[model samples]
Every structure is written in structure tokens, then in C-alpha cells.
Target: MKYEQLANDILTHIGGRENVASLTHCITRLRFQLKDDSIVDKDKVKNIDGVVSCVNKGGQFQVVIGTHVEDVYHAVCKVGKIEADSSGEPSGEKKGLISAFFDTIAGIFVPIIGALAGAGMLKAILSLATTFNWVSPESQTYTILFMVSDIAFYYMPFFLAVSAAKKFKTNTFLALIFAGMLVHPTLIGLKDAGDAVALLGIPMRMATYTSSVIPIILIVYFQSYIERFAKKITPQAVKTFLVPIITILIVAPVGLLALGPIGAFVGEYVAAFFNLLNEKASWVVPTLVGALNPLLVMTGMHYSVGAAQAVQRATVGYATIYSPGALASNMSQAAAVFAVSIKSKKKDITALASSCAATAICGITEPALYGVTLKLKRPLYATMLAGGIAGFYAGIMGVKAYSAGTSTIFTLPIYIGQDNSFIHACITAGIAIVLGFVFSYLFHKDEEAAPVEEEVPAGKTNVELNRNQSEVYAPIKGEVVALENVKDDAFSTMAMGKGIAIEPTEGIVYAPFDGKVEVLFKTKHAIGLRSNEGVELLIHIGIDTVKLEGKHFEALVSVHDTIKQGQELIRFNISEIKQAGYDCITPIIITNTGDYLDVIESDKSNVGLDNTILTAIK
Candidate 1:
């Protein structure tokens, strides 16, 4: 899979592997903890062959790679190295407050989401079996499935220990040992018996660490430092065996006797605090998350809320306010996509909106936000308003979730609790979706089409200039062909942005710009360039000429060569190219056209050497 190259490219693109503070992967994405999320080039990464999409979610820059994600992940690890996980030191200054906060929460929570979801589905299946009488709840099949459902929750500390170990740059196996000691049978037995045990005469109060969240995470954090110290002091010859032995002797007693119980108590108290909020100030949590979620999502701060929910679920068996509100928020965003699809005047926008909406409903929102709603502006506002309203109602109704999964409309059924308020909560969520759709539809107006002005602007005299501007001239000369005529949509419709085509009188090509040559296709059919003025151009020598390989072409300049305007770059054997039965269609495109607007092609039927074929307006 060329993992080394993939990792190098990703590291360089993300400003370097040193800039990453943490890393993890989900079902279809690699989540990066970058020092500065703003440095990520979403569009450039999306264009990479293996990447299906790129998103900033839960405070992580996620690159979606469909089913082959593991291949890409291995490639990333190969280039960055496995030890890169422990390199938590930021390569640069800290990110902004919101980004940092979100990153922290995402770091702590995203790793567990997959385990939790898998466990939840198992539990759901077990429930269905018991409900339908397919098997008695006490039967072997039921018991096995029950264990599968319960293991993820019961051994959550072990899972967290491993993930947190990676995040803190500690020994993952050692962290597991630390986790094991906390949840060991002897400790659980002693704690259940209400015994006050002394380890090395240091008095210890024990509590159940099974299903616990924060204690092991904190323990591993301390273990990272302890392990590093152990490695340094031990002789290199004995280091392999000495490091673990010394680290365990020093860390286990201290963690079990001190740190573990303290973290457990803190988690308990936090759970109690939230329970109090639910009992007395229930509406506040939902109201706040609902009101601010959209803004949080916009700046990528919403992952903190998800982290809080994970902590809440692990401690008290339920999460308050945020999960249901997140569900509503995502559904509202989906609704905005639908609204735009139905109401947008442009045919292209309508198609884009519909496709993005479907992707959002399936649990990805970048397409909906970046591709559609954010561009429209009004839809974004409507989504926020609807989310806030839903949150307020959910808080007042005391809506809660018992499991964690992707927050989306289809997952709404998970929120249906066995309580009277559950029905009302469901109704409120539905209303939010309707309100969001209607509001966005009513407020949004399509952007006004730019007025088309003729060349030479009505009656102005056309100036014939013999002088060449520093601007890149078109390599081929003919009537400008719109990008839509191209076969690939990624290149056509200027999704990669604008350029024109030229039908050549001869199969020879001239340099379009005064710049360093960047790429010469192996097939000898396409050339990419970066002009001195920072313009990027791709001159594809002939339509579908790639089929002929280099059979009918000869290059005059190699890549990296600095060539002047009107300099011969390639000589195409015109008669031979035609004899091979290929159209001599040439596309001279501004590959970086997104950086500029109003690229004007010269009004000419034919052009000669030194003629103005194209003009780029910055």
C-alpha cells in the first residue's frame, strides 16, 4: 500500500507528524490530533486517490477512506512510525481555546465510541431475542450474547487504559497491567467485603474498577512518566526486562493505593453532580447544549459534549441532554440539505444538496455543511435555531440516552425510553426537524447570477497588442471549450475549477506560462506547470490521447525546467496521432482556478505565436 509514502504525505500535509499530539481510527476514518487544525488542507486531501472524504468532527480532523481504511492507517503508521503515538509533545504553540478544548474531549472519548456502539448493538440483539421468546433469558445462547453485550461496559477501564496509554505516550501493555490490577478479583473481593487493606502498610480503600472510566486513564498518564524514567535508569543490556519490573514495582502499589481510588471517587462525585442537575436543574443542560451546539460544531467544539456524555454514561448508566440534542442537531442539518435541494434554483446545486443530505443522514456531515448549507448561510442559521428549540424542549422533558453511537436521525429510536416523557421527547424532536426545514427554505435565496458582459464590452475598440504580458498564454489556440465538455466530473464543471479547451491546428504545444515545469505525464499526454505568478496550469495534449501512451508524442522540456512563454514544450506527431485515430482536442486549464475569478479567454478564432490566448484576472 506504499504506507511510508502515504504517511509522509499525510504528515507533511498536516504540517508534520510532530504537529500531531494524538491519533486514532474509527470504522472508516483516521482521526488526527493536530497542534493546529486550521493547517489541514481539506480539499487537497479529499483529492487524494484513496480518500473518500475529509471532515473535522468531535475536534479531530477525520480522513474517510471507506473500507480500505486499515491499509491507509498502516501506511500512515509506517511513515510516521508506531512510536509516533507517544510523541505527545506539540511541535508548535497550542491551538486556540476552543480547538484545544475540543481536541482534549475528542482525544478522551472518540476511541471508545466504536467499542460502545458494537456492545450496544449486541445488547439490542439480546433484548430482541428475550422479547420475542427466541431463547429464554437464562439459556446458553442468551447468556453468551449477554456477556458480549456486557464485556465492553464491564471492562471499559481496560479499553480506556489502552487508548489513553496511546494518547499519553505510555506503554500500552503496561497500562493494561495497571488496569488489570485495579479490576483484579482479589481487589473486587476485598472491596465487596468492606475490608480496609494495607498494601506495604499504606492503607487503601478499594472500589469496583470494572465499568470505571477516569481512574485508569489518569493512572496511565502517570505511568507514562514512570515508565520513561525506568527505561533511562536501567542498563541497556537489562533494560527490556528491568523497565517493566521496576515500573510495575513502583507504579502498581501507588496507583492501586492512591491514584485509582481518587479517580474513581472523582468520577462518582461528577456523576452525582450531574444526577443532581437532572433532578433539580434538568432543563439547563439541554438548553445550553441545544443553544450552543451549532456554534460548537462550526468551530469543531462539539466533541467535548460527546466526551462528557461518555463519562456520564460510564459513571451513572445514562447521559443527560447532549446526546438527544446532538441527534436533533444532525437531523436539522440534514433537513437543511433537503430544503436547499428542493428550493435551490441551480440544477448543479440541487444535485449536490441532495447527495450531501443523504451522506449526512448516513452519519457524515461535512458534505452537508461545507458543500451546501454553510455556502447558503441562511440554512446554517435555521439549523441552529431549530437545534436550540429542540434542546430546550428535550431538557424540559428530561430526555436522556443509555448508549453512545453516531448522533444521527436514524439513531433516534435509541432514545425511546420506557417513560411517559419519552413519547413527548420524540414528538419534540420531529417538530424540530420540520421547523428547521421550513425556516431554511423560507429564508434562503439563491445567490444572484453574475451578469454576462460581451467581449470588448458592447462598443469599445479592441486593442491589438503585439507585446506579451508576463501572464501565461494558452498552449493551444481555438474556440474556448467549457470545462463541462470533459469526461471526468471531478475535472469538469470546475469542481476542480475553471479552464478552457482548444482544438489545435497542429499537434505541437508551446509553454503556456513562464514558470518551472512541475509534472510530465509518463504517457506524454499531459503536462502540469506552476507559473512564476503562482498560477497552476495543466495542458492535456489531446483528448483521450493517453490511450496511445507516448507513441505519438515527444517532449522538449523535462519536469522542473524553467521555460518561457511561447517556448516549445512538446511536439505532437499530428499525422501519426490522427493515424492512431484520436481527436486532437487540447485542454489548457488553470488547475488552481479556485484562487481567482473571471479568467478571460481572448476573443479569437485562431492564434499565432505571441498572440494573447488567455488572460487571468486575479
Candidate 2:
């Protein structure tokens, strides 16, 4: 609900719910398949408060929302009244093969990314535990944890089946049945025993499905068309059960005989290609990933590299391609931002840069990449140079990560398997940070530092400034809630300045004092007011009601309209808003709370329209 307003803003600017054909989300982005991309208001969406950035690439309109993207994605689905679909397949126009490929891979992988990362990290933790002899491998604790981590990779086809079924728009349960067949214990036993098998006298090729990726994806894709064909051929009356039976009967043998082996070959070839490249030119992948990751991230193509690494891990049980270089790149970005934070004289820029730098070091680099490095052109170059060199060093050292997770300083435990790999990774990170900071600080310039004021002239004495106090009355009849208790972090943390929330019992909002509306949101759920007494306040009608897109609410006065205390300002239908599943908890905030010594909330639990709610003391 906290992201509803942001979702609504995005939906509105991106040509509304109708323009959205299908929607999905990854770790940090809302991937949208819009019906008409040209009509999207990119600037408006990029400027939305919660959005980190916006990208139009891989045939999708991607809204970057950092770590909380899943929340925003659900909010978007609810607000836009659109079903969240994993099939980000284009519904409007055909796209280039590369774009289509990226979209397909993203759709198939995005849904289970959390599970994949969690399991990978758990695997790494298990490796660390055993390596350090903290837990005996024969212990039940180790056995249980190992199984927990192994299930994800061991049964990867099941996970892939579900996601691919959704992406290919096939019956998910049916596809799951197919995956079940592929990894069935009997089939696994036969393959393990090296026994020959045949379907109806035709030879069936045996290939392992456990921990496999491409075979299931190809099977599910093939299932989609076969399922449709089954539906068309079977009578409607018997279609329910008969269709599945017919589709499975036909596709099963073919998949085992042809597609399964073909997919295996493809997967093997792909993995072999990367392994060969790593073998022949070990520095190439790391240097390229290090230098170009930012560009790939900006275009939302980084997922492809991640998918390749996942494949490599599945194929060979270890990978050294992506993570090492990615670590160097992330560290470089962190260092560049930290350098900017240190060199900048402006408090706001320094604060922004410092926080973004910390986030980058934690391995979520989008904040630094989009917010700081990309904005300051020189810092991006500095990071690229630093990352490339560090990555080259890492490659030369032959560092390898034994697990998968976000590349971060703390995740170096993943490099524990290979002797000295963890040490090389650390050294690479150190090099990246040092070079990035030095290059950025030397090349990038901030605004000239403010000149120091001349010491107070001895001839002049400072004059005392007078202070004034003003009262802000209740804008609506409600049970008052302290700002700290508000659900929203922006309000409860006083990040948007001091404020008090209300659980409104009525449907109307009135002017708290004589004031003019400085700004009114298009959704009419919030307003900014400037009182005659110099108190600037913001009145938000409900939590996330902006998603209603102005429905169930009407503004009596527009922006710049002057009004007196107790005059009607906004009239909302409380019943209707509640029916639509929204909390009508209005927050009356002192936007300029810093200008006052204190903005005290009323002690009274309940307040009427005329009751004093805030006292702004200056």
C-alpha cells in the first residue's frame, strides 16, 4: 500500500492500465509490456518519488524501484486492475530477435529469482561452514541444510517448468506434470543404471533433468503449441481432461526422443562456449563484464549475463565468469560515489552520494549507477577504468566463486573453494575502490566551495531576530494518530518533515486556516497549503488513495485558491474508498517543520474540525 501512489503515478503516465499488455518484475525493476510504447511519458515516470530510473529496452518499459520493487509491482497490478503475468511477451508489436530473446529469458527467470539467490547464498554458507570445520559434514545439521540448499538446483526443472509455463502461456500444472516425468525417480534410476529405454519400440535418448535449465524451458514452449492444437482437435465437452491427455501423449515421446536431447546439446554448447572462452582468454569475460556492466544494467540486459552464469554453475558445478568482474564493478561504483560525497561541498549532494555509495558497496549498485555515476559523466568513466583493471587482475589470478549471489564484500565466502580465490577477490575489490576514488576525485569537480564570510565586523553588533507562533486546526474530524505510528516511512521517519496522522471518520476535508492551495496532486488525494501565518502544510487524504486516480474523491478548490478556516476543500466518499480497499488515514504535515522550534501535535486522541491539531512555534 505504501507504493500505491507511486504505482498510480506510473500507471497514469505510462498511458494507464489499458496500455499495459502484461507485467512482471525482477529483483529491482517492474518490467512492463505496453500496448503502445510511444505514448509513454518517460519523464513523468522517471520523476515519480519512489522510482530510481526508467528504461525502455528489451521490448519492455522497465521502472527501476530498487529493493522494494516487488511491493511496487503488486501495487501496480492492483491499482491498474491488471493481472500480474509472467509472460512479458509483446502483445502489441513484433520485436527484434535480440529484444525478444532478452524478454523471454527475463520472463522465465524473474519469477523465482528470490528463491534462486537465497538457495545460492545458503549453498555458499554451507561451503564456508564445512571449509572452516565449524560443522562436520556427517552432522544432521549439515545434512539438513545441504538438502535445503540443494533442492533448488536439484529440482531446478520444476521451478523452470512453472515459470516457463507462465511465460509461454501454457497450463502450469500440466507443464509441472511434464517436469515431474522428466525427473521421475524411475527415469532417474534408469539413467543412473545406464539402462536403455524406448517409447513404443522407438529409442528414447536419456538425459538428466535434475539441475538442468534449457530442456524444461524448451519442453514447456513446445507444450504451449501442442496444448492449443489439442484443444482445437478435441471436442469441447471432453476438452478438460482429454486435451491434457492428448497433448502429453504426443509431446512426451517427442520431447524424450528429440527436444530433450536437442535442448541438452544446446545447453551444453552454450556452457562449453563460455568455458572455452574462459580457458582460452580468461581475462576477456571479466574485463568486458567489469567495464560494460553499468551499460548492461542501464539497459536492463544484465539479467542475461546472470542467466549464463547460472547455466555455467549448473553445467560445471562452479563458475568464474561473472561474479568476480561484477564485484570489481560494484566496488568501483561505490568508491566513485564515496569520492563524490567527500569532495562535494553541498550538503544535499554529499548526503545523497554517501548513502548511495553505501548501498553500492552492499552490492545493489543501481542506486549509485543511476543516481550518481551516470548523472556525473566523469565518475562513470572513472568507475569503468577502475573496474576493468581490477577485473583484469582478478582474471589473471584465476579467482572463482563457488556459489551465486549478489556480488558484495560480505559474499567473498563464496570464493572459499579455490585456494587463494577469496584473497584475490578481496585484492581486486581493494584495487577497484582505490583507483575509482582517486580517478573520480581528480577528474570530477564540484561547484566552487562557498567563500568563508568575513569575521563579524567589530564595528557592528548582531541584531536579535523576532519569532512568531501559529496554530493549525484539524483539517478533518478524526481520531488523531502520532506521526511515528504512521505506516509510511517517509512520514513516520519525518523525512518529509514533522507531521501528525488521522484516522478519519468523516468524508470531508476543510481548510485548517486561511490559506491558499500552493499545489494539488492530479489524483486529488493530497494538497499543499500555505497559511497566511507562514506555516506550510501538506494534507494527504488517504493512504495510497492516489491509486484511485481521482475516483471517489472531488476537490472543491483548485491550486492557488484562497480559502478560510472550516471551508470545504476536498469531499471524499469514505464508504466508497473503504470498499475499494484503502485506509483513509490522512496525515497533516508541516512541510517546513525545520523552520519552527517545534511543531507540537494535540494531546487529544480525538479532534473535530475546529480543534487545534498543531502549534508551530518559532
Candidate 3:
């Protein structure tokens, strides 16, 4: 119940769960790959209480939810009946290769990033401890702690296999077995001993795979197709055992000999190229990364950079490329947002900027980026410029992050090394913050604003419908009455459908929404309509007034005629109906109330024409 309303609202604005092709959450956002981006009500979603902001980029509809996004993600899964960790089958417009790659990368990495960060942080702390002699490296405590810290990174393929299997929608155990095969003691010993290993007479490229990233991902992707092909040929009688057997038999040799070697070569070459770039110019990559980081983040190409950085880390023990530049960029964003907080006069903007700045400083930047920097425009330029300058200094100093986690003030320990790299990283962050603040304070020009009253459309109510729901508007100006108080048993018992009775004063009925007239009584006293969204409504005028209904009532729309909201559908004389000695309390019934979870009535005792009086909740 805590997040139920928020979940429902989010699903409603995103065109319901049916429109969602897949859903995943990162550190601070719920990422949705949607089938129809056009129908999403982004403004409504952004205005939801728990939602910080909404973004559409890189084929994803992202709802920023702050640190507690996991709980909210679970809530969304529960409400939508979606399986946790289910990477749904692809459906929708075909994505470009770049978009698909980034999407795949995010899906595989997002689930494990928190654990990876924790493990990385532990390794960083151990590095700090050993460097400071707080614990001797020979101590048993140190040995165990070091082992614990290094385990996740050393056996990284095992972790990657699970996440990759989910992303590729393949068998997880098979993927795990594949990872086990790569990291098996026998294989590692073979590689260590410089022995040429052959499988089924095929010579294997004894590439080290314990800490490898690309190989397992490539293998799992290949296995997804091989597994599907295996399943098709295997007889159902032995399908369970034979399918996996066939898959492993086919996948093992091909993967080890071809895919694994190819992936390792690609990873090595990419890392080598980046190293060469750094060796020749030293500052070009860092400077460009810092300046373009925000744009990269917005396009979700940051994940691509992160993937390359992961490969670099797997190849070496530390990262000098992406993490250093990202640290500078993150700190710069924090400083720029802090400047905004100090400069803004409005209480809400100041409060928001202050909180976002704090979050950005802790290594999450989406809130600050979307809520403050990008919204203000100038702050983004300030941050990017500041980041670029800081990154150049970091590059020149040869600052390297010794671990993989968020780049933050607290994680600065990760930069600790045998050289002056740690101090240089600190100086880099300081430079970013100082330059970011000064530039933002100077460049920012607040826009003069004026309050504008919102205008409501003619013949419409402000009340909006949620998912699987619709609003029924008052057709005539009248005093609202409870349905139970009506004279009719069918309505009083809710047998006709859930609705409310209104005592009519004015007697013109308007169509509630775009719909078709399904029924018009010859007596002209009752009308039945179905909305475009499938809300079936019956508007009955006066109790048993059918005795003299045709005498005072006139139907403007005929049966089966299409009508629009606010279009006149009926006209009646209230005085004549009263003079005829009949109760003129008109009841609007949702004849298909069973189709909804609940039908709720507006609390107002009196309603004006076109005002919302009933809301059907799905």
C-alpha cells in the first residue's frame, strides 16, 4: 500500500503495463522500454508525488525515483504482475544497433552494479588500510579481508554470466556452467603453464577468462540462439535433459574456440587503443569525456564508455580512463547545482537544488542534471566547462581510480596508489567544484517569471482518469444525491450499475466524452452511451417518468450516432417534469461497473454542468 498509488499512477501515465515491453531499475530510476512512446503522459508522470522526473532517451522511458527506487520497482512489479528480473521479449519499433547495445548493457549491468560497487569499495578500503599500515598485509585478517574484497572481481565472469543470461533470456544454469568452464582451475592452470589445450581436436586459444567481461557476454548471447535451436530438435520425451545436453555440446566447443577468443581480442584491442590515445596526447580523452559526459549520460552512451572501462579494469587492476573523467564531471555537476541553490530566490527551486546537489556529490547525478542543471541551461555549460578543465589536470597528473564504483568524495580512497595519484584526484575534484561554482554564479541569469492562471476547457472537468478508468461528468447542473436515496431499487441496490443521482435544475444533457450513443428510449427519458475507452453509462432522467417522458424530453442525438464530450445529447423541461408529479432526480449509472475495481463518486453535494461526479477506477 505504501507505493500502490504511485505505482498505479505511473502505470496509468505510461499507457498501462500492456504498453511496457520491459522494465528495469538502476540506482535511481525505473527504466521502461515501451511499445508506444507516443501515448505516454509524461507530464502527468512527472507530477506524481514519488517521481522526481521523467526522461525519454536512448529508447527508454526513465522515471527518476531517488535512492529508494528498488522498493518502488518491486511495487511496480507487484501491481503490474510482472516477473522480477524478467527481460521481456522484444516488441515495438526496431531499435538502432547503438540503442539496442546500450539497452542490453544497462539490462545486464544495472542489477549487479550495487553489489559491484560495494565489492569495489571494500577493495578500495583494503588498499587504503594496507597503504597506511593500519593492517599488515601478512595478517590473517588482512588475507581473509583481501580475499573477500577480490572475490567478486576475480570471478567476475560468474557474475556477468547470470546477468547476461537474464538479458538474453537464456538458461541461467547453462550460462553459469559456461562461466565455470572458463574459470575452472584446470583451464587456468593450463593457461598458466603455457600448455596448448585442445577440445575435441580443436586448438583452444588459452585466453585468461577469470576476470574477463566480453567473453561471457558474447558466449551467453550465442548460447541463447543455440539453446533455441537445440530445443526445436529435441524430442519432448527427453527435451529437458536432451535440450541442455545438446546446447552445451554445441556451445562449448564453438564458444571456447571462436566466440571467447574473438571477444578477448576485441576487448584487448579496444583497451590498447585507448591506452595508445592516452600515451600520445594524455589529455584528449579525459577532456572530451568530461565536457561531453552530460550529453553522454542524456543519450545513455555513458554505459558504453563504462563497458569499455570495465574491460580495461578486467585487463589491468585499475581504471585511468572513464572513472577519473566521470569523477571530475560529477563533482562539477554537484558544485554547479550548489551554486544554483545559493542563487535561487524561490523556496522550491532552492530546496530542490540543495537536495540534488547533495545527491550529485554522492555520485548520483540524474536528479541534479535533470532537475537543476539542464532545466536552468547555463549551469550545464558551467559544469561541462569546469569538468573539462579539471579532467585535463587529472590526466596530466596520471590520476587513476583503483576500484570500480561511483566516483564520489567518500570513494576518493579508490585513487590511493604508490604515487601522488590520490592527492591529484582530490585536487582535481577541488578544481572542478571551485571552477563550477564560479562559472555558474557568473553565467546564471534568472528568468523573470509571472504567474498565469490555468484555464479549464469549456464543458470539461479537471478530474482526469487513471489507467483502466474513466470519468463520468454531470450532464446537468443539479444538487448531487447518494444513489441509495433514489426511489428505484435497481439503482439503490447497485444492480443497474454504480452511480450517483442528481436533482436536476437545468435540463440539458451533454455527452461526457467522445463516444457513441448505443440506446435512446423512444420515451426520450433515458440514454445509454459507450465511451471510446469502454465506459458504458446509462443516464436515466426522473423516476418512472417514462409515464410522461416523451411529453417533456427531446433527444438531440439518435441511437448509434457518434457524439463528442460537451455536445448536446438531450433536452428536457424540469418544470414540466415536476408539474407532471414525478421525481426529477436523474441517476447516471456505469452499467459495466463490474468491469472496474471500484466506482467512486465525487464528494461535492452540488455539481455544475460538465463537472466530474463519478470516477471509475480500474
Candidates' C-alpha lDDT:
0.72, 0.83, 0.84
User: Cα miss at 542, model 2 (Å)?
Assistant: 36
Clashing pairs in 2: none
Q: Mark the regions of model 3 whose C-alpha exceeds 4 Å error after superposition.
A: 1-90, 450-618
* RMSD after Cα superposition, model 3: 16.8
Rank by TM-score (best first): 3, 1, 2
* Model 1 agreement with the true structure over 428-506: per-residue lDDT tens digits: 5686679779988998898995754535545444332212222557686555566568653334545444676777776
- Candidate structures ordered by lDDT, highest first: 3, 2, 1
Q: What does the lDDT come to for candidate 2?
A: 0.83
Candidate with better TM-score, 2 vs 3: 3
How far off is residue 586 in model 2, in Å? 38
Stretches > 4 Å off in candidate 2: 1-92, 447-618
Q: Distance from true position, residue 134, model 3, in Å?
A: 0.8
Cα lDDT tens digits, model 2, 1-618, are 788899899999999999988897653468788999999999898789977677786577878665456689889989989886735422322459989888788888878878987887998898889988999999999999989988888898899999999888899998998889888999889888987888899887888778888888888999999999998998989999999998899888878888888877887888899888878888888888888889888766778777777778888877777898999899999999999999988788799999999999999898888777887778999999999999998888878888777888878888878578889989999999999999999978875636545334455432211135688999999899998888655467665668798899888999999878886665678788889779999888876565566778788896666688999998999999999998888888887888899888899999998799998988
* Poorest stretch of ten by lDDT in candidate 2: 459-468
Per-candidate TM equals: 0.62, 0.61, 0.62
